[model samples]
Target: MRSRPELHGTNGAVSSTHWLASAAGAAAFDRGGNAFDAAATAAFVIQVVEPHLNGPAGDTPIMVYDAAAEEVKVVCGQGPMPSAATVGAFRERGLAEVPASGLLPACVPGAFGAWLRVVGRYGRLPIADVLAPAIRYAEDGYPLLPNASRMISALAPLFRDEWTESGATYLNGGRAPKPGARVRNPILARTFQRILDEAKARTSNREAQAEAAIDIFYEGFVAEAIDDFMATAKPLDSTGSRNAGLLTGADMAAWRPVVEDPVVVGYRGLLVHKPGPWSQGPVFLQQLALLEGFDLKEFGFGSADHLHTVVECAKLAFADREAWYGDPNHADVPIAALLDPEYSAARRALISGAPSSILRPGSPGGRVPWVPSFAPSSTATDGPDWLAELGEGIPAIMRLTASTGDTTCISATDREGNMVVATPSGGWLKSSPVVPGLGFPLGTRGQMALLAEGHNNVLAPGKRPRTTLSPTLVCTDDGRPYLAFGTPGGDQQDQWTLNFFLNHVDFGMSPQQAIEAATFHSEHVPTSFSPRQSFPLGVSVEDGIPETAIAELRRRGHQVRVTPAMSLGKVCATGARSDGGVFAAASPRGEQAYGVAR
Candidate 1:
C-alpha cells in the first residue's frame, strides 16, 4: 500500500489509472510535448495496459484547457448510433434491447478520433512519438498489475459463450492469469505499429496520421472484418440475428468527433465545466447546489447527519435526472433551470423533519429552456404480479444498476500551463468479440437502454445513451487552472468526485487525504438496470463513517448494513499551485492507479 515515487520536475505532471501510462505521458511532456501530446500518449498506453476498461473500440469525452488561448474546449468523442438503428428496428426483430453482438452494438469508435482532434488542435509533437510507448508495451508485453488481474479473473466466469472472441481471450489457457504474469497483446501491437508508420509517413503531420489510422479501422480491413462477422452471428432473440448492417463502412468512414460548447456553471468562484445532457455531469452541479444551503461541517465529517444530507441530495438530483435529463437533440433538458439557485433553494426546502423510510419523489420545477421537437420514448413497463411485488420490495436495483461499468480516465498538465481531462469507455465486451489485435471489445453502450416500449433511453436511431462517464476541470477565481481529475466506476464516480472536492475545497484536506478518506454512497440513487432499483434507499452507512455515527443513524430510523471494503471509486487527480508546482494523486483503492509528475 506504499505510495509510488513522486515524479517532479519544474515543468509538468500526468496522472491516470495506471502508473505506466502516467509515466509515458509525463515523459512526453518532458520531451517538449504539450498537455495534449501528454494526454494522447497516456490515452494510448491506457488502452494497452488497462484493456478491460478502455481501448481503440471505446468512446472518449475530453476537456482541454489551452493556456495560450486562455480558453477551454470540449470534445465529445462519443460515437453516434448508426442512422439505421431505430426502436422500430429492434421491435420488428422481436428484441427487448439491442443485442450485445454485431451491428447493433457498433458505433464509430471515438477515442482515436478525440486523440487526433486534441493533438491536431493543441499538440506540438507528432502522433507517432505520442503513441510510441503504447506501441512498445503492446509488442514487448507488460506485467499484469493487481487490479487488472483481479478484474479479468472476476469477469472471466461471465464469458460463458465460447464462440465470442472476448471469451477466447480471457477464458482461454484454461484459467485467468494472476497478477505479475507477463501478458502481450501482439494484435494491439501491430495496430499501434500501423498507426506509427502511418504517422511517420505523414511527415509528422499528426492530424493526417490520425485520419489515416481512423480510416484503417472504419473503411479498411477492420470494417470488412466486422461486417463479415456480423453476417454470421447468432440471433439476439428468437427471431433473427444482429449484424453490422446499420454501421456500414460508410458510417465509420464518415464519423468524426465533435467539439461542443461545455455547459459551465459557476460555483463559489470556481467554474465547473461539464458536458451537455449526454452525460450525468449536470447532476454533480445539482448535488453541489443542494448542499450549498446546509452546514456540512455541522455533521462533523462522516456522521449520520453528513451521510443523510448527501444521500437525500443525491436522491433528489437523480429524480430530476429521470424526469428531465436526456440528449438535448432528442429531449428538452432543463440545463439553466436545474442550476438556478432559486430552484435549488425550493428543492432543499422539501427535506422532511424525520428520516423517511422511502425517498420522496422530486419534481423538475419550472420550464426547460430547450424542448425536443419530438417526444422521446419511455422505459416504463407493465410488469407481472411477481415482478411488481419485487419492484416494491427491492428498490435498490433502480439505485445500483442505473449505469453499466467499463471506462478509463486521464488527467494531465504541462509546463506551459495547459491541462486535459478525459474518460473513454463503453462496456461492449459484455456483448461482442475482442477484435483480435485491438486488445479490447467495442462498446455496446447502446444496451444501457431498455427494450420496453417508450423508455427514456430506448435505442433510437441516432440517439446517444445517457452516460455516467464525466471528466471534470476546476479553475481558481483568478482564472488559473487549479485541478484536473476524474474516475471510473459507473454511478460511483460522481459520488466519489463530490466527496473528493468537498474534502479538498471545504475541509482543506490534501490530495492524499482527500483520496484516501473512507467514503459512502447513496443506495437510493437510481440505476440503468431493473430489479434492485431504488430498493436500498433507506440503507444506512455501515463502514467508513465512525461507529458512533452508525449507531446514531440507526436511532434515526435507517436500515444499515455492513460490508467489506469496495472500490468506492478509482479517481486520479493532478493539482497545480500558484507557485507552478504540480501535485498528483491516484486512489489507493485501485491496484493499478498511480501518479507521475515531472
Candidate 2:
C-alpha cells in the first residue's frame, strides 16, 4: 500500500481516530495553542463525537514527553474502584465477578479530570479556549463520517440495553443513524458550554476550573438526576438482581486520576515508554526480548518467519500477562521476574520447529510464591444467540483476544517538540446514565475481568481492570523523539502496535505505509471470553499483502485466512524528524481517522 501524504503541517502535527477531533486540535495549534492545548481540545471532541469508542466517562492513560525537561512522564487517568465496592460484597450477593454494569463498577470519570490536569500543567491556552471547537461541534452537528455511522449501525443492538445514555443519543428513534447523516448532541453541547464557562472563570487556576467543571456531574445536578433515575428504573445489580449498592453522590465526588511511572524498556537503541501495568504495554517489551536473538529483517517484513516468530513471542508474553499482570496495588505480580532478560530468553527458547504449538494453561514464568488465587465462576448464560455464536465460533479459531468495543487512541506532537500519546477507553457501551446535565458515564471496565477461578485478572474491589489500551512512544538514538503510536483493539492491540512499529523502525516505512499495510492477528493464547481454549493458532490477513507472501507464510506452518482490508488497530502515528518537521498519519482503514498538522 502506498503511503498517504501528510494532511497538514506547520512545525507540529496531530493524529487521532476521528477527523473532526484532529482538525479541532490542528486549529488550536494554528491559533498558537501548544500541543497540550490542542490535545485537550481533541480529547473533548472525541468524547462527544466518538462516544462508542470513548467518552467523558472513560479512563485515559497518557504518556507525555517534555522537550524542555528531556524527560517523559506517565499519567494514569484511570478511576479507582468505588469506595463502597469490595470483593466480599460481590461474594455476598452471589456475584462471581464484578458485573460490567451498576454501581460497583462505576468509578469516577478520569479523562476529564486528567485533561484538566494536563492543561493546567503544560497547556498554553485556557481550558475554555481549548474546548471551544468541541463545544461548537456538539452544539451544531458535525457531518457524519462513514466509519462513525457504521460503528453506530453495527453496534446499535448493544446500545439498546437500557443502561446507557448512548442509545438515547446516537440511536435516532431507537435505531442507529445512517452514514453521512447529520448527528448532533445538544445535551453534550450544553454540558461543554458549562465546562467552558467554568474554565473561563478560573483562567488563572486551571486545575480549580477543571475540578469545578468535573464536580457538577458527580456532586451537583448530574448526580441528583442519576440517583433519581436509578430509584425509578431500579436497574438490576451486578448480578441482574436488584440491590447492588449503585453509585452515590459521594462515589462521584471521590474520583481522581493518578500520575504513575511509564513502563520503560530498553529495546535496541531506543527507550520505549508505555503506560504502566494495568495495560499490556510491557508485553511489547517482552516480545522484543524474545526476538532478541533473531534478526527480524532477515525473515523479511510480513513473511512467515517474521509473523510466526512475532506471534509466538506475543503468545508467550500474553501468557505472562494473564498469569501475573494486574493492578500492582492489588495483585502480587512478578513484574521484575517477567521483565528479566534471562526469563524472557528462557521463554523464547520454548518456541521450536512448529507452525503452532499446543497452548498450555499456565503462567509465563513459574507461579508467584506469594500470590493467592482470585477467580470467579460467573458465566454469561443469558445473551442472544449471536454473541454466543461469536463466543463459540471465534474462540474455535483464536483464543484470548478481547473483542469489546469502546476504545480509541491519539498521538500528538507540538511545535515545541512536546509529544502526548494516550489511549482513553471504557468497555462496551455502558448505559448507566449520570446526571443528565453532566455528559459523562461511570466506567464499565469491570467487564474486562474474568469470572473463572484462578485466573490472574479476576475482579476485585479497588483493582484496575485488565485493559487492552496501550499507548506507546519511542525515542531515537540521537535523543530525538521519533514516534508516538498506539491502537484500539483488545488483545489485538499489542499485535497491531508491534507490526506498525516494526514497519516504521525496522523497515524504514513512512507512517502511512505502516498504518495502511495489510495486517494480521495471531490468537494462540487465552482471551477475555469464556470457553477460552477453543481458538485456533492462525493469521488473518488483509487483502493488500501480496499473494506470494501469504503463500510463503502458509507454507511455513501459518494458519492463514484472508479477510477484507480492515483497520486491525484504529492505529495512529506521529513521527518527528531530525529536521524538526512533524509527520502524522491515521489508519485509512478507519472511516473517521485522519491526520491534521499545523
Clash count per candidate? 31, 12
What C-alpha lDDT values do all the predictions have?
Answer: 0.67, 0.67
Please state every model's RMSD to the true fold in angstroms: 5.6, 4.2
Model 2, span 487-583: residue lDDT tens = 7776778888888877776777777887877787777665543334424567777776678877877777778777666646678877676777787
Candidate 2 Cα misplacement greater than 4 A, ranges: 6-8, 101-104, 145-168, 214-233, 236-245, 360-406, 427-435, 451-456, 529-536, 546-557
After superposition, candidate 1 runs with Cα above 4 Å error: 1-9, 99-103, 146-161, 167-174, 235-246, 353-405, 427-429, 436-439, 450-456, 529-532, 536-542
Q: What global local distance difference test value does model 1 have?
A: 0.67
- Cα distance off (Å), candidate 2, residue 75: 1.3
For model 1, how does the per-residue alpha-carbon lDDT over 1-598 read when each residue is reduced to its tens digit?
2244434545777888888898898899767897789889999888888766667777778988889977777888877776777778776665555553334656667787778778877888877788789889987888876555654554454444332466566554756678788887777778778656755665555667666666666777666665555555542311123244366556667777778877776666787777777877778888888988888776668877887787778777766765566667776667788888898899898775345544443445644322112222222235322122112211222224332235678998876778899987753333345665455666655645444444455566667767777888888866688788888766667777888887776666777677777676666655543222444445534256688876776687666665434346667887676787777878766566778877
* Superposition error at 419 for model 2 (Å): 0.1
